[model samples]
Target: MGIKSSLSKVFASFVLKKIESWKFNAVDAQERTLQKLIAEAKNTVFGADHHFHDIKNYQDFKERVPIRDYEDLRPYIERVVEGEPDILWKNKPQYFAKTSGTTSGVKYIPISKESMPEHIKAARNALLTYIHETGNAKFVDGKMIFLQGSPVLTEKHGIKIGRLSGIVAHLVPAYLQKNRMPSYETNCIEDWEQKVEAIVGETLHEDMRLISGIPPWVQMYFDKLSEKSGGKTIKDIFKNFELFVYGGVNFEPYRAKIEASIGKKIAAIETYPASEGFIAYQDSQTEKGLLLLADAGMFYEFVPADEYYNDKPTRLSLGEVEIDKNYALILNTNAGLWGYSIGDTVKFISLNPYKIMVTGRIKHFISAFGEHVIGEEVEHALLSVANEEGVEITEFTVAPQVNPAESELPYHEWFVEFSKAPQDLAAFSLKVDLALQQKNIYYFDLIEGNILQPLKIRTLAKDAFVNYMKAQGKLGGQNKVPRLSNDRKIAEGLKDYIK
Candidate 1:
């Protein structure tokens, strides 16, 4: 059933008023204010036998139990997956999300009905906050295009379900939703090629106003739309949209192409979401970096970037978190997940607890030769080169490789497909290399002797990695290509193609 727009709008208005009342309330208390709520969710959803007897505060709770991760609740999750009734947790997952994080390999994460409220509420709060701040949501009448997974899971009979993008498609407030290409309902295509075709078929229509998804997928979607119309842009297809919201990974690479395709100064909203929980988001023009959903029904902990690998880590509340420093966020959410490290890193952009900017992923880094390089550093460096060269290459990936043939020189290789090109490779590569060095002092020292040189930029046809991920049976959903990697295997394997 389609969501009633009037009713949803009324509810949204009410929700927005309440969120505005928060006023950075996430830092009002040193202890979690929603401990009772999280406890209630835990006992009701997980069927927990034990209850908090004496703990009166966050510190007490911290002392009583250690933090946790996904593996910690294998027993409960296993039961939920098997569809066991009357389990401690209440929400049965509609479907498991396909995510391959640092620890979770080829993993299927259950999205419980109970846990989803937190995700939805937090996301709503962020979106509303954006509206309140920008005063421009009315531009499209609250009709949004979210590039999320389809609700249908691809299963036997080869029935094609919406990928993670499809799931989000179903989850949005209905009037904002569309029957865009590759309807998760009927797209029996699982192969990326097939799925892309299916989505392309639907996207060719002119009704798709406002789009959201990982930048690559959105880029691919636009490329398909353009191809279908023989050089027409998204502006020609869904010319009505005035805003574009995207997160998951950096969208800077494709920012130019996206703007050109849309033919306007598209309002870009960046969000920070993880499998464990949706941590922070920023769409509000008044604020920079995403505001951590600090006041959500969750207890939070912050581990300084340098101390993430510490033997005995010290955790802090939002108030205690420092500004401009990176931290590995820890959360004790309503889902009964505690001390769960969501893996995404962030920077505090403001004093308000909710303000943060996603720095990068914890696992996706290039440090093969002890020269630690991450997403933001590489992205900024590339942007600088692009600016210098006056080119727009939005799609690129970086991998660390030691070329044995080149006397085992540890070099950073970049595979970049450009909408525009820099004036010179030699100068651009040196500038990128210096930028990386200046960003990471350690990298600077390592490259001082020319032991490791600058970056390599190579082009690819628009849907190159899209086709690659599709070939691996990973094309249809939340899955995305890693932006940076330390693994020599992935580096060497994708190297030839980078050239």
Candidate 2:
């Protein structure tokens, strides 16, 4: 091993020990985190308003602070935007992570000095854990690229404002600076297409090993490499490439297509990151779920997904969560977001060390006929059938078709983009329908009672989702089409691309 590789192994060993110490004591770590957050923020404006000083336990917190989404916290955020101090956290935030919201036009999520390092540390430890487990530290010496938004920042009242990924770009550690790829100028390209092209030009022949990004954008980079290299697989172009790290979406649906592009199966890591916090990361290659970051300067609360909209939902702390149950994730972070709803739903797969799988968004589901099928269910249903039928799907989305032609019953419409179409589309559709019925009992009852017809599939033309997102000005950079929608907005928009 080279000098860097040797140093990496030693560092990984050290970090893994520290991780083990916390992982085994997850509940205690979480309790300590809550106490620390409460003690530190009690002097802030929100703390006083919410009676944080009197909070002594989880029950007190639940009664004192109400759950708040971005809209509910907008007044405080607005004041902070106008250069106010100590409105949320102890002092002014170091940066504001700008993100596009569905109802709220734009959101500015604070990144306090205390919270910023946690993001970097969690990401670092994820890789370190991999190294310690698999003895694979050589990738550290090769060039790495993270497909992301423009790193260019705009100033809002002295706070740097940019995408979460872009803000993270500014914080890449000094040790990895030389090994990181697609020069700063290339990363600053506002247009994603041009950015990918530039990235391909910069790293096409370099010793690239680690490629990290949300899957679709990484797929775009792979496509560009294939085009430039005259259809050669990624393995052929970058012989040293080994690890694929992804976040923001589940990797299973895209797994077949991505591995096909690479021409081989490779080691991969999944992470759960958001503008609010870095919640979890896959700690073991053999493990089923991402290990929750219980001590990462944040405390978590989980409300049962079914009861999320109710007046008084049951909020459970880490020790209270159970395996295989879906919950809407809530956060109280050092960044000064208390009882904040980030809108993502997750399920605990392992509670021994608190591991979870991101199930879907709280708002992204189809329940027109009371089925309430989520993102995980739809993806699972399709993937199970696709694997059996040897089909390769590029992308897909589900929406409730509440109305149909005369004499026809309403059904769920699945818009699918296929790289490899199945031999028998009808038979394939039936299999997928059966799989979904098995996963969701309500949907099965609806079909059996003749309240709705079997779901229908609409094959989309090649690059259909890409074109749709492009038209919406959300072509890349953390933007993704919802896997499931209650309304026909996306389904209607996708009609033009139907084959």
Best by TM-score: 2
CA lDDT of each prediction against the hidden true structure: 0.64, 0.93
Instruction: Write down the TM-score of every candidate.
Output: 0.85, 0.99
In model 1, which runs have C-alpha deviations exceeding 4 angstroms?
A: 1-13, 29-34, 41-52, 72-76, 83-98, 101-103, 125-127, 137-144, 153-171, 174-189, 406-408, 449-451, 455-462
Candidate 1 Cα deviation (angstroms), residue 348: 0.8
Worst lDDT run of 10 residues, candidate 1, spans 155-164
- TM-score, candidate 2, is 0.99
How large is the C-alpha RMSD of every model relative to the true structure?
Answer: 4.3, 0.7
lDDT (tens digit, per residue) of candidate 2 on 1-499: 7788889999999998888898989999999999999999999999999998999999999999999999999999999888788999988999999999988999999999999999999999989999999999889999999898888999978888999989999899999999998899999998888889999999998999999999988998999999999999999999999999999998998999999999999999998889899999999998799999998999999999999999999999999989999999999999999999999999999878888999999999999988999999999999999998899999999998887998999999999999999988988998999999999999999999999988899999999999999989999899988999999999999999999
